[model samples]
Target: MAGEELKPSTVISLADAMQAYSAGRYAEAEDIGCRIAAVHPNDPAVWNLLGVVARMTGRQPEAVACYRRGIAVAPDYAALWSNLGNALKDLKRCEAAIVCHRRALELEPDVATSLHNLGVALTAAGRDGEALHAYDAALAIEPANENVIWDRALSRLRLGDYAGGWQDYEARFGRDELPKRDLPGMRWNGGPYAGKTLLVAAEQGLGDGIWVARYLKRVKALGGEMIVECREPSRALLASMGVADRIILQGEPLPAVDFHIPQCSLPGVFTPDEAAIPTEPYITADPQERARLAPIIAAAAGERLKVGIVWGGSGTYASRADRDAKLAYFLAHFNIPGVQLFSLQKGPQEEELKALPAAPVVHLTPHTADMFETAAAVAELDLVIMTDTSVAHLAGALGKPVWVLLCRVPHWMWQYGRSDCAWYPSMRLFRQRTWGDWTGAFDEAAAALQMLVLQRSGKLLTV
Candidate 1:
């Protein structure tokens, strides 16, 4: 009813634009939407479509402008308000987005999208309990909403309800964002695959692959041959650690297997209880690789205590920006008298090292290309100080002493409020006392690092 009374040419153009957007031709849709907006400046529908296309194309600011323009034209449009809220949420304006979502809900009380958006905003604002209630209300309206179900899973897990959490987490497989694998076998249902091959396909990030590989040994002991499918970067390291009987890269042609399971689902099958989590390091560096890199690292260290530092994770990660610590923070805080810091950071964030603040921390990331090399380099280090990144998982997997700086509400794997990680014996968690407050975490880490440095230098006896 919104754009129905327009001219015939305008109607056809609007239809074309909507079809293009629905078909995933965002660029074409954006061009058409802009043309329509220019010709019919009063049409809120055209502006709304432009906003959607802009948001889909990673133009959040443009999307916000378009949504604002649409709101100006049709101030009472509930859909426009909800859409604007989503864009604002993406821009990390959680409180403002929440306000928009609430206004949308006031206009259209039964709108599931508004409810779901409200849930997401609340979750980002660290109100997970209220977020769950919002999600529940949305689910009541639309029971099979995958997005709401997946988000609800995260909220449940954050609250430390593993039993309730894992069940809902299964909804992630159906979410469109995650790449789905279509293997030619039955899904593993926590049963023994005696004398058969079980393909453990990789899902999610490289760190998740390494984290879940711990359960592969258990899968092996179940009287079955296990084939672990992982990313190319992880294959060598995981193979070296003997995570499975056979290791294969993700894009390789699948070998015949009786059943298959995603790596992330391992926790649901094996260790559902938090207390029963395996603490021993299941991944180890190759002996030859470790031997080869040990001298190179020692020479770089000279006479000081070697500490590997990773200030950032992959930028593609959803929470990378949130998890990242300022390189300057580490440079200023980690200046222990007898300690020599080495950067284990890689990717685009590596460029930040050029601005190192008078601290002579060596950058070892160039020497470590893949996880195998990272594990080898980590093995040679005295300690690792890192944010919530793959390097932390790698250091922990190698049984190296790692101090992991966590966000106030860290990933579900870290669990609720414990300083020591149950999965990695050598890893210590430094959590933020307040949300988005890395300073407090850094202060605690600095004190612990000072004690460690003193112990290393024989100035203190206890660690």
Candidate 2:
């Protein structure tokens, strides 16, 4: 009923454009699609083809405009509505995206793809309960849809359903995003390897490596020579744990181990629920590194409450910006009288400090050569405050007093409707109430820091 208005000639041209898009020739597809759109401005297929090409080429705004134009002409077309919803979600316009997706579902109620898109939009809006229902409805229609299952896993995990979530999370290995590991040994089945060596292969972000490092001690207790393979940046930090019989940097020669388990999968093996999560301080700062940095920190901080800060995480994830807080935002709000801010940020983002006019925070990247050095610097601080990042995991692992600034819908591990972190007893979570709003979380952290300073000063005076 929606696309039947297209002429036979227009349909043939649309097919050619779709074939080009399928073959990954987006430019060719876009050229053909644009030509059709110019000639047949009223045809929904032409606009849909143009929108798909625009989205595939990473021009999400153009895709939204194309979809809007198509919807104006053919409002009954469910595909255009669904495409618009997806583009809006990519732009972080969750509420509008949800409405667009629901409208598409109203037009094509049985379409699993529309339901899946709606679920994703709902999740972004932090309405994960409703998101789960949408995902379930999609799964009921297309029982083996990996896209639907994967998103449902995230929703379940965010809602603190670790058991069901982890079970479904195994679907990630089947998906392309996480990348499958092709190691030498047999995949360890989470059982004891009494006489054999167990290799813990690290995967994903540096924060994930640090978060899963806690499971190494548990693996060692299962009675085997524990070998951990980690990225170069995390090598020193994992080595300091002392749980692994050997720490191997990633891309090095594979050691002869009887069994191998992905570092992340270790959680699924051991942790059944939130209460089963291992407590923090499993990771320790190199004692020598700490001793070397402590005097330097004392010299700079003096009597001030030494506060370390990390404003951004790794720039890999598309959704990372949601979790990032601007350095200026922190400096503006955290103008407490007794606190001295220290930058623990690395990577290209550290350049943001130089661009700023009068940055009060002391830059500590020069002192931090690796995770060991970073951990030591963090240990010297009275408290660590940061957006959700690897440094937050580092500080949390070391059992330091760390406050984490969270997006409205943060990572599954942060959970929903909670201020305390189960994995890190010393870590406190400050979450945004509204989507894409960091000011609320930052303001709360500033207020909390003021109280912490007063508490510490009162304790010092008593002594």
Candidate 3:
């Protein structure tokens, strides 16, 4: 041996712990770490490693405890503080988590990762401006930090800083962590469409397609030949944006063009600000589609005023996908007397509607041919109420009379702490004050519908 020394038993155990952790043997890692911790109670590294293992294994409380123990042992480890903050955030202790992140940033400023985490915690706490600053701080150190830039853009959007937000919103494409687009066999760079035609395809969820399809009009305004390739659910709606030169299902073939842009890239290309929101509902039911569905809607809508309702969206979230509002959940608590209800809901929820008391209501969801058909049906309605679904986006995009019911932690488009959606001038938001409790939202919706009903009858009720 170059240097004669006794190998520390605790250090050996720690090395074993690291190996186990790296091998994905979480239980083995936990045991090895605990053994070292028992022998070297003063070693903060052991505790920190244990915390990481705990966090990895979904024992968030244990992770928090381990982090705290590490911090107590060595209060100066900025990384330990940051890890603790992340654990607290997983526990929904956002305020405490931000404090820990801030402390870590203070002790070692300009750390990009911690700064990004700090922005996330701030945004979760509904502190948008501070979150924006945190993200900006991270960007100041690493300008192309994609996630930080994305967060900053969202924060800008929520604060109604339209120009800056849309300008930055373009950063989402081709980034790591974003879903890979299933190229419908062709792609383009969005070059001038003067003599060339490009097929703009949609790569994300239907809501995204709906929101960004507003840019298709800009493309049309640019005097280019363009066709919108969208999710099957969005064909009609995209067609109605008054811009797409053609509308087809995702992956459908189209006339060649100079370049192509994803539907969601419209904001990036058009630089949409509040002034450029394309607020008017340009998509609607064509005369034939409306006429075809008139009998069905009329029969279902009957003497009572019709309210097309959807309380959930297609699953686009990773965590808590199960929290989607089931129509039965809301209907169980609802007893709207004069408001004849129709379920404009699509996908899996349509199957469940067969079990509800819908004799007074109608379900034309399955019959809808496209977004245009849906919009036509929606246009026939006195109002549309829905969960954070593409239906909401369509109604909102169309500037139809829409009432959106959102989960407490809704999609970013609703913006932070918002009761109104600027994207759709006629849309109103009713958010869950607490997660999974639609009672409050339903109560508000019921009241609003009552007011709407009263208004229809020439009675003005003050809110």
Candidate 4:
């Protein structure tokens, strides 16, 4: 279509493939695109469409191959270059992706979408300053693009520019991919809303609710009775915080309130700088619940350094690859002589323990029903060691000693280049020095655990 003419039948087939792709029917699109690529190997459009479909279907290697073939046929095609860049980015080949994106821009400099994709690849590669500059360029071209604004918000937050970041973070609502609640009431923007009841509905995941629960107390101080609506799993934990005047679980009838706000947006209310963030433990396990779970833990631990471990987060998370590790990997490294490992992991990942030759850790997931119960079990333990999951937030909130293993590029909240968390003072972060490599992080954690065991037994002297 760019400069060459195709047979009427071929053109019709290509149009059909494009329509199928737009309808989210990946199978239909891929079939048509594959047929066309076989018949018309000389046309870059066929390969480009196939590449796009491959990327959508999560076959990143196939997508890269398709894009490369298309680029070979039509070296000047900016779309082919851009698509190749995206596929390479998905494969975590950031340097190659950056080169392809730059070539795309060279061919078509004014294309804002190309710039936005470039920014994403750059951010993934940890060149955040350059990424921000690219995002700024894209925004200058299309100021109203919500997706660009949302990404820019993440970069700004990662850089610790909380005030500016929160301002742009509001753009999240404009993107359709994120969940939205059409609750009954005007959304609370900020400032004092005296004498009026406010409903703070927890958004995203369980970890999100725990992380933002710290803001509820401050919201209450803004002169209104605050109501917290969270997932059923977290109701008890939220109730224990005593931050909200009333607590309601999700799926229940909405209580009448004058104003409603997403729990995650609470930070935007004050636009708090780093120093203003509440670092103290604001959540606790129910004392009664903790007492109940203590004996079970003590009987199993038998004076060894009691440690709880979670090797994975929720599978639905987009960046789970970077954030999660294999359960076998943890078992391999954490086989310390004087340490007792307890499994606090929930979700389908808990099944990974069954495939093991024998139970390496004490299975506590059976005793722990929800986040609150998990917290009680965690309270009885000497320490919690886990990947970045909801339990990490729970332990941190409880003021328990926690070691959080992180990927090279973690979430914006974890920020960049620090061994300790500002949000959780008791948290010690063990980050992977190389992308996709957890050996260094795991080895360091193993050494630290051994030291902890020694210190507890008075075998090692501490200053």
Q: Cα lDDT of all candidates, in order?
A: 0.85, 0.88, 0.75, 0.88
- Candidate number with the higher lDDT (3 or 4): 4
TM-score of 1: 0.86
Backbone clashes in model 4, listed as residue pairs: none
How do the residues 280-319 of candidate 3 rate in per-residue lDDT, one tens digit apiece? Answer: 7656667887888878888866777878877556655553
Question: In terms of lDDT, which candidate is stronger, 1 or 3?
Answer: 1
Backbone clashes for every candidate come to 0, 0, 16, 0
**Runs with alpha carbons beyond 4 Å of true place in candidate 2:** 1-8, 459-463
Give per-model TM-scores. 0.86, 0.94, 0.82, 0.95
Residue lDDT tens for model 4, 370-437: 88888899889989999999999999998999999998778888888898998899999998886899
- Rate residue 176 of model 1 by lDDT: 71
Angstrom error of the Cα, residue 261, model 1: value is 1.3
lDDT minimum window of 10 residues, candidate 1: 1-10
Residue-wise C-alpha lDDT for candidate 2, range 207-255, written one tens digit per residue: 9999988888778998679889899999887877777899888889988
